[model samples]
Target: LVTVNLTANTDLNSAEEFEQLVIRESGGAVVRLKDVADVVLGAEDYDSEVRFSGQKAVFMGIWVLPNANALDVLSGVRTELEEINRDLPAGLEGGIGYDSTVYIRDSIDEVLKTLAETLLIVVAVIFLFMGSLRAVVVPIAAIPLSIIGAFFLMQMAGFTVNLLTLLAIVLCVGIVVDDAIVMVENIERHLSEGMKPFDAAIKGARELVGPVISMTITLAVVYAPIGFQGGLTGALFREFAFTLAGAVLVSGIVALTVSPVMCAKMLKPGMEDHGFARLVNRGFSRLRDIYGRALDAVLAARPAAYFVWAVIALLCIPMFRMSPSELAPSEDQGIIFGIVDAPANATVEETARYAEAANDIFFSEPETDFSFQLTQPSSGFSGMRLKPWSERERTPNEILPGLAAKLDRIAGISVRAVTPPSLPGGGNFPVEFIIASTAEPEQILEIARTLQQKAAASGMFAFPPIIDTKIDQPEAEFLIDRDMVASLGLNLRQVGEDISAMVGGNYVNRFNIGGRSYKVIPQIQRAGRLNPDQLESIYVTGPDGRLMPLGAVATMKQSAQPRSLNRFQQLNAVKLSGVAIRPL
Candidate 1:
């Protein structure tokens, strides 16, 4: 059993910590993480693509674990925050956000408050124009019926009640009541002139219906273009278009159908006069009086007005140039990552150990939450996984860099660095280029060295610890004399078993405790696998039933070679990777 305890200064991300916790609980029986690999502390390798309000921030997505309920986990996370908030680190605060569904449900209460406020505003506007109880009540009735009807339509059209939709509702404060205003004002004027209430209402509504319907249709058409934009922009604004269009249409219908009926019921001959009504009437009379005066002055100064208009138009042209175009506004969600590689021929166990140490660095610093995952290259003569993948830690910023440095110490691993991920619709970094060549490794190395020098002198990248090229490996030989083995009545297969047993170690059955199982690996006693002298000193059974020394059948020699090599177009190549401080 391998035990890993994280301590301060261990800088690690949430992903790495999650990975380590998984390793500790699994007990290596289902699979020995170590047998497969090592663990260590390192820097944040992945870049955070998004930023919030110009400050660098990353998203740490949280999902309910299997067999766990979302709301329950959400509650737990909230509790964790309360605990953390009691003593938060400087410059940081924790907040939670939900998906669209939950957001709408929570915001619906606020929408009701807005709805009430809108009603109050519409009442004030009506009192300003028409000045009586009959006038104020008519337009106010149109607001709720229009909105409720809009809500039903939005539901049918699959729209969520969100910011844009709510904005559309707010916009309706002026628009939806206009038709009601026109109908009510016309009928009241007829009543003042001594017409019967019912007759005045019918005549007024008939006179205004054409213009009201035309205006509503025109406004709806103006917003129709938004629905066709497509993708993210269209998806966001579609609800606004839908709700606003529905509200206006409903308001128009109510003006024609319901307003006339209500006016007939409410209007009466010689109704009681009130002080507020007189004030409203006097205000409109003054407005018309002022407008007549302004009209005469504007006509006399038409040339000056035109000159001012031209100047304003010229000023607006320059202002347009200052506006910025972007895909979307950025948001902050704190997150971090740790990337590292291990030494050649290093066992999985060692790799996991290295990762755990890195995780310790993160937990110690108490950065954001973190998690990690590990993958390995396939077994082969090339000593490279066709994938050449890795294990990574997802953590908060406080622990990321320190964690990355810890992983860099592992064997066979190189080119470890921390970087933020690319932005949406933007190119991502850490992209590797496998430059293949027919030239020898020496030549490849030389070319790599030159490229590195050019890159360094160019001042194009600001990140430190840049490595231009990496050699695959040092070469070695395993000599087996088939003839000598056959003469002794021995087989090559047996020799392979002896070597495999001596090195790879055989796996027996498993042992279980607390419902968890671990694999039992049996290894032959060996002085050292890397020492040729020790290989010669080992013993194996021969065909003659006599123990034969390994030295009698083979010779060992050293040579330079790559543990892993990649090719492009049948040419030998090595990959060069590094973080660019400024995005290219």
Candidate 2:
């Protein structure tokens, strides 16, 4: 229901406001967007995302409501967006476009009609060979019942009536009834040889049932692996397997139960066999005679046949040299892309601005599709994710080059931009590393430098040097003497409380407006707040109710600290990861 570009730039506050406004205006029918989906705002996601020629870019896609008609809802959404685009903010302009998944079912339905026509042609061929319309009717009657049975089972199993599954059923339209036709034909053959209709119906099926059942079971067993062994592709293909299994199983049962009963009543006396089957039977009978004679001729010339076999084996050796071995299938999922990046030590506001700038191009042209940014992924250094979409526009492979040219013009970037890669599953990467450590910051800088050198020397990863490293941020590190604080009659907790009030501030409660809540923040006035050099001058109350200068027992100076710290297995550590292409 909700998706994001890994590198999009929309203000988190603004995206939150827009989401809340929509939910509020809907009169709570769509009560909790976050409950049903993750309405995250951040940079576009990159796992399975595309980048414009290694520049940050993103594309988004939306799934239609389960119960709603896709075309109707999408059309209404398009209309609403067109109206909204008339009043965009300055230097901000974009247009919405369409994607085929919105209307693909309708197209599939059109294809199904052609498939149905082909099926009818196949049925007509069956009648022509049997020389009786009754033969065609016998098998065709099982088609609808078989299809209905599949639908009922799919519904019971909580499966959506999707294209991949339906294509299997469409494919069965011609083949499903073939077994019944064969059983009925064999019964007609028995009748021509002077057997009673009831006896022929029963005996003919009794003779053929073993082979018919074995063939049907073979098909079901072949397709059975899809249901058990498949991974993500299995989820898509399993339904096809099950649907075909169901149709084949149902048609087999119908062939044994219904087709025989129908044959007894419908098949006429003295019906003639004609068409390709008749020609096949006669020609094949003569070919058997020819083959027997040829076998004797070949046995007498066995030396020449062995010479031909040796020559063919010699030719096949070179074929192995031309064959390719692959580890995984190459992917091509339309043309859209996604991207997520962050500037060095960027505040959330600055990150949002960069993301919005990147998102601007995605939303600019009318032909451009959809764009998304996870503007506020989470608190504490989590940047945004952006994704954009296009319809008639070029694919990610085509547009990335041009998009890279455009993004290079932007300033203040910390990482070399990269495009999203194609993936089988449409999703964003979850792991993002922000390298920070507490070893005097300068020591941490050295650690990062060593890591980059080692990784580059490994000759496995081809990306640019690790770039999250940066100059340490200035902080006030105070060393308070324990005995001096006791002499002042002030405990450490009291000093901590006073410092928290002066710096970290306090959260005052909330105000409710029309059932909505907003946080109220309280803090010292900006001009009165303590800076690193001014920390020494700040005064704190002692236990005897006397004012004492903070400089007396605690020394303060400008020192560096990491923006964040990470722990691995309860020990401080730094994490680094990136995509690996063809490795040495």
Top candidate by TM-score: 2
What TM-score would each prediction reach against the true structure?
0.51, 0.58
lDDT of 1 by residue, 322-348 (tens): 776444432122334344554455454
Q: Which whole-number lDDT from 0 to 100 does residue 202 have in model 1?
A: 86
The alpha-carbon lDDT assigned to residue 173 of candidate 1 equals: 67
State the weakest 10-residue window (summed lDDT) of model 2: 377-386
Give per-residue lDDT, candidate 1, residue 579. Answer: 53
Candidate 2 ranges beyond 4 A from true positions = 1-134, 155-175, 184-203, 229-241, 262-337, 364-367, 376-393, 396-409, 414-476, 481-489, 508-520, 525-584
The Cα local distance difference test for each model comes to: 0.61, 0.61
The alpha-carbon lDDT assigned to residue 545 of candidate 1 equals: 61
Tens digits of per-residue lDDT, candidate 2, 1-584, equal 88976876433343345345333225446554343334333332212332232233333556776577666766787787777768877754444333444335454675678778867787777766555677677888778867777787788766666666678788777767878888987998898898888888999999998988997898778776787655666765788888778778777878888889998888765654455545645665698999999999999999999999899999898886766633333232333333445533345556556555665655543444444444321111111122333335444445544665565555633222333443334333212344554455456657767777776677544343443434465567778888999886779988876666555645445544456564444344445653566766777777686667777878875665665655545545555544333322
